[model samples]
Target: MSKEKLFKVAFMNQGKVYELHAREVNQSGLFGFIEIGDFVFDESSGIVIDPSEERLRSEFEGVLSTFVPVHSIIRIDEVKKRGNNKISDLPEGANVTQFPSPIYTPGKGKND
Candidate 1:
């Protein structure tokens, strides 16, 4: 008998933090993207209705795999059991900052 592996991935998107679970997490062939698959969730547990979990489920529904940018990733951890997958707003006064946008236009350079 072998124990299965599970991973909890946390990442930043726009101005929010997204937490999800997966069986596999690895660097993808695509540049600057991380590949994630085998999403896990509590499909049978209907005791409580969680909007966050429901949103995640709907967002990922029918999707076999996904690619996330490395810069947006906050952390990844291997866990013994799956927890409530969720999306949350970034806390105020947080030290971490998002990637900056380009200041200069491609064709219209500063000199032009």
Candidate 2:
């Protein structure tokens, strides 16, 4: 028997921090994105349901795979088991921000 791999991916989106578990995490073919697939959630908690988990489940429902920009990704780790996935607001004055791509520089040429 072989054990499966589970990944915990954390990222920032719209000023909120998101953490989730997935079976697949790989570098996307796109220029600057990561591919994630096979979301995992526990549904055997019985009568009680966590709002955060429910929210995440609904948000990812019907989603086969998702791509997140490399810069937005905070961290990725391989875990032995899945945890409760949730979204959290960025702390006050948190230094987290969307990575800005350099499109142009407004200085004189290097040769100048």
User: Which candidate wins on TM-score?
Assistant: 2
All candidates' lDDT scores? 0.89, 0.89
Error of 1 at 11 (Å): 0.4
Candidate 1: tens digits of C-alpha lDDT, residues 32-66: 78998999977776777899999999999998889
Total clashes, candidate 2? Answer: 0
- Write one digit per residue (lDDT tens) for candidate 2, span 1-112: 9889999999988888999999999999886789999999887968988888899899999999999988889999999988989999988978867867843556798775
Cα deviation of 52 in candidate 1 (Å)? Answer: 0.3
Q: TM-score per candidate, in order?
A: 0.83, 0.86
Q: For model 1, what is the alpha-carbon lDDT of residue 102?
A: 46
54, model 2: CA deviation in Å?
0.7
